[model samples]
Target: MIGKRLKRLSPAIGRAYIQLIMELDERISEISATQLQKQLKCGPGCDGCCIQFSVLPLEAAIVAEAAVAKNVNAENNGESCSLLKDGLCSVYEVRPVICRTQGLPLAYIDEEAGAIEVSACPVNFPDDYPLSHDELMFMDSYNGRLAQLNVQYCTENDIDCSVRIPLADCVC
Candidate 1:
């Protein structure tokens, strides 16, 4: 299932897939934001979860292109994300995949434990509102699809496949 259409994708098609994935993630985030607005503390000025994190190489590559176009630096200061400027994400328009999931109910299927681990920021879920597993955003499926797309991208571009780079490293 992974490599069925490996080399069939052109860079243009790969870019389209990346855009579609980003749109889907944004749509899901919007749903969560609307449904849990009362319980969610995340807002424009909230950078609580904007700490350093890694993103897939494909994400980094895309963001790197944006960084150059925007004339913004993507350096890592070994503190908070270098993208933050004046308490806001400088590259918010092209933020990485992990940045899109902050302050949302996220679920991960642990195969070894055979259970779905669900969690969100402590500020969320204060009202004991029951959220079904299907209601939460699942990372496994998203990540798998991303990996598949990344494989196609790498294959088409002759880049290394299956690599995760620090967000800072990707830009500069």
Candidate 2:
């Protein structure tokens, strides 16, 4: 099922998307090592945040490719992620950006508040945890890059740039 969708995307876009994902993973690892060491509570068996979500066509295509490669036939578990099997992500290696950064300190510009706000999973950080500015991952930068790549992918694939594909639908 997913193979058909994967066929629509060019290999160049796939390589670019994978490169971006790799860079994001590297950055997350760097931050985790320097800022979140001994603080991150997320690991195997942590599925609280593993819920159904939407992704760009580029992301969906990459995920679909991974699912096909892994021979994953994920069944949507209501509100939970379809990729979850045996309490672990079956597509962990090619999981989306959101999954990669979950439980980590995220910083976003609160448009209404006109200020920067930082947040993390309640279980991962203490209420009084003194979060440094450098420790927080600014999502805007990464998201912007992802969006740009998605736009390029969509343009090349003749897909709507605004189209958001459900993660579960990526699995065969």
Please provide, for model 2 over 31-137, each residue's C-alpha lDDT reduced to its tens digit, 9 standing for 90 to 100.
89985788987899999999989888888887898888899987868899999997799999878899999999999998999999887988989889988888888
lDDT of each: 0.69, 0.84
lDDT of 1 at 48: 73
Top of the candidates by lDDT: 2
TM-score of 2: 0.89
How many times do residue backbones clash in model 1? 0
Clashing pairs in 2: none
For every model shown, what is its TM-score relative to the native structure? Answer: 0.78, 0.89
Model 1, 1-172: lDDT tens per residue? Answer: 1111123456675577667677767767666656566766777879878877777656766666666667777655457887777678887877866787777788899999999888777676654768765567777877777788777677766767866666666454
Once fitted onto the true fold, the runs of candidate 1 whose alpha carbons sit more than 4 angstroms away are 1-10, 26-30, 75-77, 126-130
- CA lDDT, candidate 1, residue 97: 63
Number of clashing residue pairs in every model? 0, 0
